[model samples]
Every structure is written in structure tokens, then in C-alpha cells.
Target: MGVQRLKGKIKLISVFIVCLIITVFPVVTHAMRGDCGYEGGISSGEAPNKSSFEYQEVCFITGEPIVFKGTLKIKKTYKNNIINTTYIYNLDNAEKKATLTRTLNYRTEITEKDNGQITEKTYFQKDPYEVIKIDNVTYTLKNYDFTRSSFIDQKPSINFYSGDIWNKKTYQTGGVNSGRSTVTVEATGNFYGYDQYWGSAETQIINYVISSESVKNGKIDKWTGTAKVTLSLTTTKQLKYEENLPEQSSYKGVYMEKQYNESILEYSCKLPEFDSKGVSTDIIKTKSGSLKIETFPQSQPLSVPDISHLRGHWAENDIRILYSLEIFKGDSSIFNPEQYISRAEFVSAIVEAAKEVPKDPAFEKKNTRTAAARKKKEEEVISPFIDVSTKSEYFASINAAYDRGIVSGDGGRFRPNEPITLADALVILVRSVGLEGMAPGKYPVTTFRDNDLIPYYARQAAFVAQEIGLVKGDTRGYLNPNEKLTKARAAALINNFINYMREGIKKVYTEGIVNYN
Candidate 1:
């Protein structure tokens, strides 16, 4: 009897356990299925969004082809590793009731290579790709029910401009003198224009903060700041054209702040905007003009020791040569004889003088006949780097200066409106003249002790100039090359070069006359 009772209890327990396993296994399976699909588990039932846009991305190296990439996104709360996945759709025009699915189809080719042999393969990801397309638009998955998407582009553009504003009066007071400017940018491109095979474009808001401001005269001249902005995934309607879009978009542009650099005058800041992931980053576009963030007064004070009373002492011939070369245009046609010269203008003059010597890299890509035709139309001259289309006028002199290599640009960025310095001018002049044979003479006399400041390569040129009376000492007996070159000093220096050249010609002529006689 005891054995029988034990057997019955065992049988009953086995049946109960089997029933429990049957009930719990299906529930768990259903939950797992709900995690990743369009089954409307805990997420909305919808597809991802799409758009079509183009960007010119500069490569890390110079002269490299620009790399172009596209992005798309889906809006669903579902997430599955095997099949379909969902994403949060917070765009401005998204429908709360619907979900989004997305996929990326790069029209790429595949190449197959075997050892000692190579085979070329060509494949184009056609529009409306059936394999990649899920319910609306998505990359394929094993289960296919997940709402969270496998692919999306989470970046958008935010750029703009504000006009120039200056506080010139405040500069003299030793306060932070600055100028102000701003830029406003609206979304210009969208990814949805591409075929339906790809998912809609999307972005995730990370941080939208101010980037930087403009600078003037080497100071924090002007800057910008951004107001807080909200992210919008989709537009209220389609953005068929740039003009059709309103000035105000759901995603506001990033802000900017300015800082001053005393060495620079005209300053520009790259625009700030959202990256592919909707994070704030500097927006730089070659097509769109760079952001001019600030303008500041960049004048430095003259030291008491370097101030000299000597002013006007140059000949007409020298000035003419320099002027024709666009090197030295005299300070006030009257030629002031007793004025303190600034160091900045001096550098510019010397650079201009060097430009008189011809250099190539000009006329490289020009249609010479056409350029000459417009010579009088304000389009004849411009810096090699400046735009010839709209800013042809101001760039005339700059263009001439750049070609001679008298003045070089800063990291490919040129500050056209900045002032020049005396030392800066001397360096450019020394380099531009190619003073290979012009070594200093062994004359046992010296005036300026700081003549040693000239670099060894430049020493030969400086010494020769001194020997030939091209560079004269100031009243205080100092060669203030580091000082800002004033217009007056520029005139004087140019005159000196002309004299040097003429005296040599005279010497040669006299020797010839003697030999003939």
C-alpha cells in the first residue's frame, strides 16, 4: 500500500511540473518577441523617416578628394537584435501615432581579389532596395519585429551670420574694445529626397552651445553666444526648396562667443552647428563664407626708448620705384618731416617693396586677355586667394602682395585688413630680395647694438644694407625693427633701396667710362 501511494504522488507532481513549463515557456517567448518588432509591444507601430542632402567634407589632408556620406533614421520605441528595432522620434513634425523604420543604401561597389589575380566586381544599391526595406524603410534582420533601428544619421546643420558692430571709442580707454556680429542659419538640405529604399533622415540632440567670437587688433573685439534650443526630428511638411523654408526652424542654430587676439585685425570664426549626431561642432563650409565673429583695434603702444625724432630723409627716385611696385606710398603726399612712425605700416611698406620683384604662381590659371580687358573695371587685381567674383575690388593690392611672397598667409588664412610691423616688414623684405651675395662688410664700426637681432640668414642682408647706407640708425641709436612700421618709415626705407641701386649703377657706369677712355 505504501509503495502504491508513493507512485501516485510522483505521477501527480510530474503532471503539474509539465503544465507549468508549458504555460511559462510561451509567455517568455512572447515577451522576447515583443522586445524587437513592429508588433506594437511597448512601442508605436511606424517606419523610420528619410531625406536627401549633400555635403562637401574636407579631408584631413590637403588636396584630397572630399568624402561624402549620407544618414537616415527611424522613429519607433521597439528594439530587437535579430529583426526590427525602434527609435525615439522627437522631430518637429513627427506623428506620435506612427513609428519609423530606416536603412542606408550606399551606392558602393565591391572588389574581389584572389592571390596572384584580381577580379573586379560592380554592384549598385538600387533605389527602393527590397532586401534592405522592412515595413517602410529598414535594413533586414532575422526576427524583423524590433522597433529600434539599426541605422540612422543623427546630425543636422546650424549656422548663421550677424553684421559687424564696433566699439572704437572704448579701445583708447584700455577697456576690452570689441566689435559684434551674428549669423542665422536655417536647414538647407534634407535626406528624404532620395528614393524610398533608404530610411528618413534623423538627428539626436546632444549639446547646443556657443562656439567662438570674432577678434580685432589682437583683442577680444567681439563674440557671440547661443540661446537654448530644442530638437525637432521631422519638419511640419516637406522642405522642397531652401527658399520655401521659414527663417525659424524647429532646431535653432548654435551660438558663438568672441575672444580678442591683439595680433590680428580682421577675424573670422567658423560657424557653430550640429554634427551628424546633433552635437554642437564648428561648421566650416567653403561655399558659404566663413563667419566673421569680431573686429577689434589692434594697435600697440610705442616704447619710450624706441621713439625717435628723425623723420623725413629720403629721395624721390626711391619712393617712385617702391610706389610703382606698390611697396611704399608716402605718408601724406606732402611727406611729413617730423612725425612719429608706427611699426605696423613699416612692415606693409617693405612687403610691398619686395613684391616689386617678380614671382610666379600668378597668371597660373588666369585668362590673361580677359583679365586685362577688365583692368579698369575694378576686377583687374586681387589677392591670389581672394574671390575674384564679388570681392575683386579690395583684393587688387592684396593680390599683388601675395604673389611676390613678401607676405605669407597664416595657416592658409589671410588677415587682409591687419596692420604691419617694422620687424615683420624687414624680415619679409630680406627674404623677398634674395640677398645671397650681399654679406656685411668688415667695417669696424657699429651703431645699433641690437643689430644682432637679425637672423643669421638675414644678417648678411642687414649688414650689406648698413654698409651701403640703406638702413640708417634712429636719433636714439637703435634699430627698432620690431616696432610697427609707419608710413613715414616705409617711405624712407624705400628711398634707401632706390639709392643703393642707383649708386651701384653709377659705379658701373664710371668704371666703363674709365675703361673706354
Candidate 2:
């Protein structure tokens, strides 16, 4: 959003990557938490499949809440929007003398939205498959499921979430549930969990109200909630001195029992949390602890320019944030802070900041000559708009942004060289992050003196940007939406957007979740 860095004053996520968007504005109303539930994770990673897991589990074996310390081995891959994951959990309860390994085959569907939200649909076309091998055989998991749906405002200052999970793992030999274990693993936020074998005959029914809120702080949202759980586990089946130890060693035995726990469902990250204190840290720590996925975004290099011009400018800090991320690559030292930025330049910068990974979308459609489409499409001199050429330095970002519906051209031509207006920039910025049409009304008014100057099409975007603290009018309270955005002004706007994403979004997601609980 801006060109400068925040000097790490706000703690950015070390491994936060590819999160979702929500266009939530209405106050979310979640019913008071009745029964206890569970949720999310965050973890330190050694490799793609290696992660740490530390959480308190309702252990039937111990008849008390037992802390399960272990590593959740995960291998996740994304194709076309579907994510396939393999989870291998090897856990040991030292205090409770419990040990087990559970493997889960999980999948999720990811859909990107323009309204500042991301939706993940689980078990849509796939079934969750799991296998278990318990040497101690204290219990058996007859059922397991979880739901996780997280939403953050565009300002991203608030994280809104509500979810419920149910389980039916029964004891195999202990005194509760006829010696068959009834075990459940529940989670909250944008998804549902079901097991093919466990859920095929009996459905998992959760009872918490489907409450939604935009708790700009809420009265009912909890990042973690408390509930009473009837847990169970089996004491060792007392096997005596056998006449033949050979046959006894080969014999398999199962036992189970039950216990109830009324405790807060908590998950914390063992990784370095954000710089900000309070609930934000707890959220980050927990989200990071999720045993679901791993993201290691490769960093790119940016050229350093002698931009002494940034000194004393209000946009300096924002510009530095972007600069640290290497958003300004091609430009050199004379970086004009007061000059007008072209539409192409603005689009390119937006695309880069969003990390769209510029690619010409048309190439895939245009090169669809072969039936199998086996031929690799090479980057050619193709352009979406008539005026922009492949040779243009801004071509990739422009094309990529256009393909993603972040920008558009007029009359089949992209006026790349033209100066971008304030109104136009607002539209592009809102669209770039899929934040269009999310304001309270179809057409909203701004607090600017010259609000009438904004074109009819750009009014909604202007309102959204203003509401999200992205657009601030001049000292005279004039929106100046129709005016060409000066370099200094553009720097400020860009920086503001960056703050929304990095600081604001991070704040809500990390800390807001803690509060939501």
C-alpha cells in the first residue's frame, strides 16, 4: 500500500501466507457459548512436512485433561483451488502414560473473494480418511470432525469467527459407552469435518447457534470457548503370568473408560509471535499452531535507490515499508515523489503489493490449440489491451492485475500512459483486493467537501476506501477524486493500504481471534 516500512514496530507474521478475505460489515451475533468447543493451530516448521503440536486434549485414559505434546507431520498441496493434506500425528502423554499415532487424509476448497474474505469449503467432493494404531489400545476413535471459519475486516482490525465440533469416540473396553470410545476433535471457522467411515452411517450434529458478527469487539465471539466434555480411557487390562509368554506377547487387548472435562479449548503457537502484545499474540500463536498447512513464501530481491526525496515526506514511512518488500524495483534514485504516476505504474504497484505473481491470463486461453493442451505456453508478445506491449516493464503486473479483475481497460484499450485520477485509483485499489461493493449501501457518501466531483461509477469504491480508512480528503475536506494523484499523495494512499493489510489485517486476525474467544 505504501513505499516505506513500519520499521518492524508492528509484529508481522513470520509464516503467515495466502489467507482469505471477507466483506463483513454487519454486526455478528453469536449466541452465548453454551457447550465447550475447539479451534485453530500455528507451528514452527523444519520442512514442508515437519511441525510441532502442543495442546491440552480431553483424555479419557487419564480421566483428566492431559497435555498432548507431539509433532504433526503434514504434507499439503494445492491444485486449482483444492488442497490435499496428509496429517500424521504421533503423540505421547508422559503424565498420563498414553501413546498413539493417528493419520488423517484431509482436503479443503479455497475460493478468493473481492469483498475482503476468503472461503474454504471442506469435504465438498472429497471424504476425510483416517487410520489409527494404538499399542496401548486404551481407546478407539469411532468418530472425529472439526470446523474452522475465520473472517477479518478490510481494515483487518477485527477477526470474526464462530464454530462447533462433535465427536463419538467410544471406549473399547473401559466402563463408559459400553467399552467403545466416543472421541471427538472439534474446530471452528469456515469449514466442516466428516470421516467416511465414522460419519457414513451417523452424522455429526453440532448445536451452537450459527451467529455472525462484525464485532468491530463483540459481546459473544470468543477466540476459544469452554465446554464440558465427557471423556473416557481404559486402564491396563490386567493380564496375568501366562503359562506361555510367546502367545501372550502376540495377544491384542482393548479397554476404555470415560471422564468429563469443563475446560477452555486452547491451542498456542510455539513459534515467535507478533510484536504487538495482548490477544493478537494469542491468536497468532494459535493460528500458527494449526496442524493443517505450511507456507514458506520465497523472498524476492529489490534494487536499492538513493531516495533522499523521501525525507520529511509524510509518505516516507509507508514508502519504506513497500521499499523493504522491494515493491519499487525498476525505478532508480530520482524516484519522483511529487510527480504524477501513470495508470500502468499504479496498477503494476498494486499487483506487486498483492503478490499476484504477474502472469498474462490470456496466454492460457489463446494457446489452447492442442486437445490435451500439453504444449507449454511460452511468454510471447501478447497484450490484453491494445496500447500496452509485452516489452513494457509494467506489462506483467498490469496484465496479472487485469486478469484477476483488479483493473480494467476502456474501449478495448488500456490507457497505460495516462495519469490515474484519485477516483480511478480508489476503484483500482478496492478492486485489486476484491473489496468492491462491500460498503453498507449500494452508493455511499464521503465526508469530502467536493464529494459531488466523484464520478457515478467510482462512488461506491470511494465510500469503501473511506470507510476502511484508505482514502482521506485534503485539508480543506475536498475529496479531489477527479484530480490526478500526485506522487506524494499516491505514496500516502499506498502506504495506508499496506498498513491495512500488514498491520490492520494482522492485528484483527491475530489479536481479534484472541478476543473472539
Candidate 3:
């Protein structure tokens, strides 16, 4: 009987050990999975594990005052040709108090770029009563309203692990009251372990400054400020299993709180002050104080091309304007201002600009006829160029120019890729302005030193272009008609053309028509 009892006890011990292993195996595996190791590789739905606990919390605090400055200028040209200009300047010299409460909702989208960099876009919303104050003025900026959506990019921080430190720079710019302001923020981030009260948490300490200037009419304003901010996030929470609770209800929990204190170290504002006599005066206001902010989790989020190497070029502004209008797109952001432009490119730009021109009834009728002919099945519409295919991207623009008499291809070939000469460009410009037959048959023999070199067929167009200040002679007084036109010259000429169309010769010829003194 004693032997049988001892054997039974051993059997029970074995069973107890087996049951313990079964119960603890999964929990140990889960805990180990949360350890992403020292290496930065993370599996999907892993690492940054916010689901290790029930509730997550986030908080933000500001350390210093936010300084801001702005300027605004407005200019208006009336139909009667009257030009009016106004300038207003504003400088805020006060302790800035602001608090932002954000809940890290989720990673809505992740984009992996060709450069192997991953961009994680997270959506967040601010809590109510986010206060912004500048001295005595409490700005009710709508951007702080709880109903807006806000987002932040987490690319550089995506690979960060516990105890890691990272630095980031951010820039934000926006239009404000006829002016614009730019804010630059520099931040350092400290990563904490996952599964904390705020899972997948990080603390960011930041320093930010703002500078803004604006112009409208004849008024101008300038503003500037500096401040510090602290941002923290606890992205997600893991719910404890409970028999009676709904799964969805358990997973939808988030908490946030924030506090801010800003001391205005230095503050000043320069603005335009008017006296009773309506005379302009400059006024400066300076003050300092302590600003406090309280914040909660936001329910609504608030959310708010570079040209190459054309610096200091004479036609840079013109090129930029044309680019903004989509009339000119240089090869890969390169204006290549000094490079000669091809006939195809020149014609394309001209046609694009013409699209914005006020439609003339006569031109409208011509365009209508052109469109009709293009649609008819029986009308075997012939292309003017044997080289240009209907499938070519520039075909429509070239065809439109041909129909409008803005350009006439040579022979049966458009020679679309050939470098266009100065004389040819002038002829196209002259014809584009509806002055095809208005040029004089004869001009002063001394108008250009190289007059004899001018092609007889292009003399009238050259004369018209020169008379309208659309073309200029070289320093040696030569027309250089046979020379290939450069992109810079083309941009300048196109700018002059647009100006003539808008303001006419009388207003645009402020410094006289001829380049010669």
C-alpha cells in the first residue's frame, strides 16, 4: 500500500509540471516577441507595441515663449490704370502661451519611397480650448479649433528603439493677413520602452522660431518670434481580457493631457502708426510676461517645386512666372537660361500663354472652326507637318498654333527640334500679336547695323517686333537675326509680349521703346 501511494504522488507532480508549462508558454512567447532585439528590424504589427496594456496617455509641455513677427503689402491696379499700394507692419512682443493635445490615432498610411526611406503618416486631433495668446491679444485662430485634423510625419523616428535619441527639423509656412510666416522647429526625441502606461512612447523637446513678411499695395509688415515646445505620445493600448466587455469597447480607449509655461525673454513689435493728420508713423511695442497653457486629447486634427541654378539671371523672374503659369517647364527643373531654345519648345510656350489671353470674338470663331474640322469623320484633316505625329505630346499645341496663323512651318517639315533663329522668333511673336500686316515696308537704313543681313521675307516682322520693343539689338547695334535665340532672351521677350497684351505700349513703354539711350 505504501509503494502504491508514493507512485501516485509522483504521477501527480508530473501532471502539475505539464499543466504549468502549458499555461506559461504563450505568455513567455508574447513577452519575448515584444523584444525587438538591439537591431532595428521590426515585423509588421510588432515593435512599437502599444497593445501591451489597457489605456495609453500622451502629454505635451512648452518651455519658452513663442515669438512671431509679420509684414503685409498690397498692390491693386484698377481698370482705369490707377495703381494703388498699401503697407502694414505688425510686431508681437508678448509671452506666447500655446498647448496642443493630440491622440496618436493610428498609422493611416505608410509610403515607401524609391530611396528606401519609409514615411509613416499618422493622423491626430487636438483637444478643445487650445489657447494662443500674444500679450494682451488672445488670437482665436481657427487652426487651434478642436474640429480640425492634424498630422505628423514619423519617418526618422520609425526605427528608433528604447533608450535611443533622435533629432528632427521641421518647417511650416502659411499665409496670414496679406503676408506670410515661416516657422522652423528643431527637436530632440527620447524613446521609452513599449507597454508603459503610454505605449510606444517618446518625448520630444523642441525649440522653434518664426519670421514673416508680407506686402500688399504700398503697405509692408514684418514679424519674428522664438519659443520651445515639448511633445510626447503614447500611441496605443492593449486591453485586458474580460468576459463581459465587448472587444470593440475595450480597444477604443485613449487619454491625453498637456501643460505649458512660456516666459517672454525678449519681445518687440514694429508697426505702422497713423496720427490724426493721417501721416504715417512708426510705433514699437515691447512687453514680457508668463504665459500658461492647459490641453487635452484632440478629437479633430488640424492640417495645413524648385528651379535649378537660375540665380541672379536677368530673366529669372520672367522664367519663374512662366513656369508658375505652366507655360514653360524646363528640363528637370533646369531653366538652362543661356541655352538656345528649340522651335518646338518656343511654339509650345507661346500656345500655352495664348490660352490665358482674353478671347477675341474673331479668334473664338477660328478656334470653333478648327475644333469642328477636328471632329468630322469625312474631313480628312491634313497635318501641316510630315514629321509631327498625331500621337506626339506637342502635336495639339503645334496644330493650334498653325491654325491660329501664329506659326507657319517651313516646307513640309516643321523641323520641330531645330534651334529657332532670332528673326524667326520675332516673326512668330509679331504674328501672335495680330500685327502681321501692320509693319512698314521700309525702315531707317541705320535702324540696325546688320540691316543688310536681315532676310527679305522677315524684314517686316523684324521691323514690327523692333518697333513694339519686343526685340532689341546687341551692344554693337546689330540685330543678330541669324543667331539662335537663348532661353533667357525668350523669357524676356515673352514677358514683354504678355505685358504689351495686358497694359498696351503706352503704359509699358515707361522708359521709352528703344534700348538705346
Measured against the true structure, the TM-scores of the candidates, in listed sequence, are 0.27, 0.57, 0.36
lDDT of 1 by residue, 391-498 (tens): 433343544444443444443334444454444444444444444245544322335677765444345545655655767667877776556555556666665654
lDDT of each: 0.29, 0.46, 0.42
Point out the higher-scoring one by TM-score: 1 or 3: 3
Best by TM-score: 2
- TM-score, prediction 3: 0.36
Q: Report RMSD (Å) for each prediction in the order shown.
A: 36.7, 20.4, 31.6
Question: Which has the higher lDDT value, candidate number 1 or candidate number 3?
Answer: 3
Worst 10 residues of 1 by lDDT: 189-198
**Over 4 Å off, model 3:** 1-305, 330-332, 356-381, 442-446, 506-517
lDDT per residue as tens, model 2, 329-387: 55545677778988888887776565432111111222323434443344324466667
Give the Å error, residue 94, model 2.
Answer: 2.4
After TM-score superposition, what is the CA distance of residue 446 in candidate 2 from its true location, in Å? 2.0
